[model samples]
Target: MTRPRRRVKLARIVNERKRKAALKRRKKALIKSLNTICVLCGAEACMVICDRTNNQGTHNKMVWPSKEQAEAMMSRFKSLPQEQREKKAVSNEMFLQSLLAKKSKKLESLRAKNNQMEMEEILHNFAIDPTSIEPATGKLTRLFLYINDLIAKIEENESMSQSATNVNLV
Candidate 1:
């Protein structure tokens, strides 16, 4: 029969050295069980983010590589045989080119959309009468009335100037 597992009383451990040693062992075991290794590049120094599901089955959580680890992995890849290295380089170049092309296409599409909106705005301003487009709200009616009064004042001034000029000519 399997012996009952003993519970560790970490709080009760008074010896500092023993407590530190127990903590180290526990940390190592936890790390080992968690398998903190990068599945992509097989780098041991990595961080686990979260678990993900796939068609095959559930797998261990994804591992994100640190900058130093990623650089080391890249160096290892560079040290590969000549033909393999060349093939990888070509594939990487193609991947980067494809990404750049995709980004450029997206940027062009955004610019086209922005230009279309600007053209529509310009055309709307020139083609459509603002007052005819919709019924005036109370605020807009007040604004229009104010504008009419200004126009009437301008016309009165022009007529007065014309009458003064006629009297001078007579």
Candidate 2:
């Protein structure tokens, strides 16, 4: 008979091998699922589903009749595999556009920062003493600053919206 220590070592090795094999099987299963195989019964050529219903052939089949039943089924499950999630397969055009939109947002923010800095420099250069303040001149400058700030905000929002637009990434 094997020594206890040797038997324990052998068991650990066997368990490790089983774990590795199971992981490999799981990877293959996920790949197969992404290719439209059903998760429940491993049925290929079946309806693509966000999550598989009980061992039923119809992948998207609901176990319960009403919303409560559906919610209960979903809540009972701990989690679904990433492949089983309803993630829209990534699209090339959307990916590229999102990349460009991110770039545009960065550029826009940089430009706004530079503009604000320049305005601050100009304001500092055209400094007026508070003690000798001209009411009319101060009011006119305040009005111009408010308008410029509003225009900047509008431009900022437009650039921000561009990023949102390319998100067909679902």
Candidate 3:
């Protein structure tokens, strides 16, 4: 059998100001309920309602380990053999270094892609327009100035790269 559609309760407040105030109060209560921490565990284990109901609904919070329990577990781990601890530390360091290197590579690739897109946009704007050569007034003058600046920058970059390559060879 097909399930019947659930009906939602309409707000009793008809006035605009009163309805807004009611909404604000309900929002504050919901936020407070969600931020509530459990007494048994130190974790924020408050349950949130996903239904269409206006009520905050039931709390089905999960009980996690308290701070004392976590500290005890850590102490047990620290009491392991010196060689094992060293191996664990070394592996953690290597893992962290590899993660950092991977992130750096991704950032470098994004930067290169951004630079290439900007260069292509500049080339498209400057090279595709033939009107800049016909006049020496207003927009044409500005375009010619921008193109000259871009040419100077390209020459400077080429010289810098050539110098760097020569230094690397030495």
Candidate 4:
């Protein structure tokens, strides 16, 4: 079984050396992930990372898979309209924020669906035996309401179909 991932708290490392080491390690992992996705999906992608913190000022930027290919990709990107470029461009902070927003939205949706899913399970138990499960009064009411709503919808659909068939026959 796959182990649950440990959540890494996003915080700045106080120690400069450790911070630098972490940056290098994370950067390598990011590049690997990009390469893996590109190769797996057969995507044409150009990535440019500039390391201003590099000890050697001579080679501060790295481009993949090749400098020539990266330049060509960049040229195509530059040819796009300003609005198009702006729309596609996302800062690191913006990316994290948008990602967090999406996850939060999904989490809310899941939480909302939890009750419906639980009601379904309860209904399943009731199908086997009405006395199989003893839910709280409030829960039972909710379950009954859910069942009633479903039955009403089904009945409405059946009536509509019957009317349609009657009209066709006439």
Candidate 5:
């Protein structure tokens, strides 16, 4: 007899399969609806941002090199037993090297993004003295307004004292 957990798992699997089928059907319909002809090869294709050899009838570009092509290549390499499969091995090695370089570039970009984000946080949060006409926000602006009010009060007292002195002199 199936346990309670097993029943739950089966229900989840059924739901997931339905979801996958719906998604697949949607994709197929969209592809079918693609009305554009491929410019590069003049084939009926579904790609939107079509660029030459990336010309595609579908989202996946590099259709496998074909069994016949592989067999031909194998036969050529077989004829040169001494030459071995050095070319194929070298090509594979280069492919991995390029992949490694791409990964390195992506990592560098992420690190730069993080560094710039931290710098932005510092710029926004830094405290500036509020006496100047420069733009301010949040607590900084409030502090500036408070200081300006104090300065205005002091000026009013100074002007009143000067007028009193003038009146005494007269």
Candidate 6:
């Protein structure tokens, strides 16, 4: 049986020789995978790796399917309209903004639901024993306002239902 692979730490390798060797092996594997995917899906694919500055202060690059194919693909991409090119682009800032908005909306929704539940519980308790919450002036005012709001909603719903019934009878 094949042994399971151990999880590798997602950190930069400190040893220069080991790091470069691993990079070479991994780059080859990546290009192989890209070729396999293209062959299986009948799709054009390219991979580029821009290495960090070496001791000589020179950068190196690795490109799959030759430099010519990658350049053609890049040029084709550049020819597209600006809007079309960035239609579904998600940078870190954009992603975080969207996430923040979603979380804020959800938080607001939860707060409203919690307030509704708390008001309902208070109303139930007050109905069971009116003297239990009489000591708090602020709570009493809030409870009164909540009750008024509930009454208004109930009346609105009843009027709409009655109007619908009348319309059906006509």
> How high a TM-score does candidate 2 get?
0.29
Stretches of candidate 3 off by over 4 Å are: 1-75, 90-103, 130-170
**Steric clash pairs (candidate 2):** none
Per-model TM-score, in order, reads 0.26, 0.29, 0.27, 0.50, 0.28, 0.58
Give the winner by TM-score: 1 or 4: 4
For model 1, the stretches where C-alpha displacement exceeds 4 angstroms are 1-80, 90-103, 130-170
lDDT, candidate 4, at 47: 81
lDDT, candidate 6, 16-117, per-residue tens: 999989899988888888889999999887888999987889888778888999999989988999999899889999999999999999999999899889
Q: For each candidate, what is the lDDT?
A: 0.65, 0.59, 0.64, 0.87, 0.57, 0.90
Tens digits of lDDT, candidate 4, 1-170 = 99998998899888989987987898889889999999999988978887655565565877878899998988998999999989968999999999999999999999869977999998888889998766656768888799898899999999999999999999
Candidate 4 lowest-lDDT run of ten: 50-59
What tens-digit string does per-residue lDDT give for candidate 1 at 34-129?
A: 454445556445444443354678754534345566567668876988888687455777989999999999999999778556545544653676
RMSD of 5: 20.8
Q: Over 4 Å off in model 4, which ranges? A: 1-5, 53-59, 80-154, 160-170
Winner by lDDT? 6
Residue 161's lDDT in candidate 1: 100
- Candidate 6: deviation at residue 123, Å? 2.0
**Model 4 root mean square deviation, Cα atoms:** 6.9
Cand. 4 Cα-lDDT: 0.87
lDDT (Cα, tens digit) per residue for candidate 3, span 1-170: 99995874675777868776866676666656545644445543423333223346654332224456546656776798888768746577798999999999999999977866765665576588654344544555555566687799999999999999999999
Better of 3 and 5 by TM-score: 5
| Residue 47 in candidate 6, Cα distance off native in Å | 4.9
User: What is the alpha-carbon lDDT of model 6 when measured against the actual structure?
Assistant: 0.90
